[model samples]
Target chain A: EAGVAQSPRYKIIEKRQSVAFWCNPISGHATLYWYQQILGQGPKLLIQFQNNGVVDDSQLPKDRFSAERLKGVDSTLKIQPAKLEDSAVYLCASSYGPDRGTDTQYFGPGTRLTVL
Target chain B: AQRVTQPEKLLSVFKGAPVELKCNYSYSGSPELFWYVQYSRQRLQLLLRHISRESIKGFTADLNKGETSFHLKKPFAQEEDSAMYYCALSRSNYQLIWGAGTKLIIKP
Candidate 1:
């Protein structure tokens, strides 16, 4: 079976520039998530979506970050006016809905964003 | 506030030796814990969950509520076992708190 997929495995941008990352989850999975992993750290949850609606985004930087799962299958996370501190790997993950006894999340090959 | 702690940033063991990666967490209510692994150049994937009570790739973890710890263990470590491991706690269905992660290195 195909796993979660992401685009632009690597990206570089200058501070104050904008960047976007895309994700395509596994088929039939109902939950999608975006995470940020700074070097030497584990991935931090940035946002989550169930179907076409957001389930949680409390950690998202509302002033600079935005994400959308319009059709409920694919998602895009964007950061505007990127800062040097924003340089990190952007990871995408997905899971089968809660109905499944074990909601194991599968992750994609993250996009490494380097803001100079 | 929920938190996951991995005390060790790096651990090394010889092949055929036992391996343990320590994890501790802080949560008030019922806690759900998970272990995720990422091999070199691979995406992070679930290794095990406390609720399952099942072992994967000879690795297992038991949640100790009394001490607030969930440590991953494996017997007879192999070179293939070298990877980064992360312990996480679920705050909600869609939210998870993760530790800094531990890098396990197995010597031949």
Candidate 2:
């Protein structure tokens, strides 16, 4: 099976600008996740989706960040008014799961966002 | 609140030597631990999980519930083993708490 795929391997935008990233999860994966990994740190969960419905987004900054997994096959994460602190690698992962975090997750080459 | 901690930010060892990466977690219930690795320019991949009691790529981690640790170890380190390793704990709610990660350098 192919791994998760992500678009825009690298992006640079000025502060307050908006940026979007796309992800295609592995075939038949019911759970999709978006994470933000800062330099020198581990990835933090931004949002989680289970078959087109959100399962978790408590850590997401609702004011400027949003994500959607329409149709449960593809997902898009958007960051509006990107701040310098938002400069990080945006990672996408998926698993054969129904909101099971213990499932082995297949990852994609993350999109590195640079907010200047 | 559940949390994962990797005390060493970086560790360097010579090739063919033993390697150990420390990990400690805090959770109320029985924890599901995992070790993930990322090589240069590669996507992060799961190396092993505590539930299976299996070793991958010559690496093994014992989940010591009494000590609250799951330390990854390999008998003989290879240059190819150099990468960033992350320890994660699965919470009761099925969410994950991740550690900052440790960068392992295998010197040839």
Candidate 3:
């Protein structure tokens, strides 16, 4: 089966600029998530969506980061006025359902973003 | 707060040697543990989970609540075993708290 797909596997932008990453979850998957993984660190969730409705986004920086899962199949995460510290790999994952952690999460290749 | 710790940043083992990747977590309720592996040029994938109690690729991890650890172990390592392994704990059965990750290198 096809796994989660992401676009522009790598990106580079200047500070205070805007950058956006796109993600398309696995077919028939119902839960989607976006995570930021800094170098030498594990992934930190930025947002989660269940069938086009937001499930959680507490870790998201509302001032500059935003994400949307329109039509419940695709998602986009955007960061405006980016900062140097925002340079990290952005991963997208999806699960068959919101099984509260039991379901296996399939991840994408991730987009490596560098802010100068 | 909930957190996961991988004491070792990097672990090197010879082929056919034993391998162990330590993982510890802090949580209040009954936590679900998972080990995820990311090979070079590959996406992150589930290696195993505590609930499943099944070994994958000859690797097994046993969750010890008293010790608050779920260490991944394999009696015999292979060259293809080289990868980044992450330990994660389910928080409130909804979110996951992940460890920094351990880079495993199996020398031929």
RMSD of each: 1.1, 1.3, 1.3
Given candidate 2, what's the lDDT at residue B85? 99
Which one wins by DockQ: 1 or 3? Answer: 3
lDDT of 2 by residue, A1-116 (tens): 78999999999999999999999999999989899999999999999898898989999999999999998899999999899999999999998874444478889999999999
lDDT of all predictions, in order shown? 0.93, 0.93, 0.93
Candidate 3, residues B1-108: lDDT per residue as tens digits? 789999999999999999999999888899899999999999999999999999999999999999999999999999999999999887653567889999999999
Choose the strongest candidate by DockQ.
3
Error of 2 at B86 (Å): 0.4
Off by over 4 Å in 2: A99-102
Return the DockQ of model 2.
0.79
Candidate 3: regions farther than 4 A off: A99-101
Estimate, for each residue in A34-53, the C-alpha lDDT of model 3 and write its tens digit.
99999999999999898899
The TM-score values for the models, in the order shown, are: 0.96, 0.97, 0.97
Taking the tens digit of each residue's C-alpha lDDT, what string does model 1 give over B1-108? 688999999999999999999999999989999999999999999999999999999999999999999999998999999999999998657467899999999999
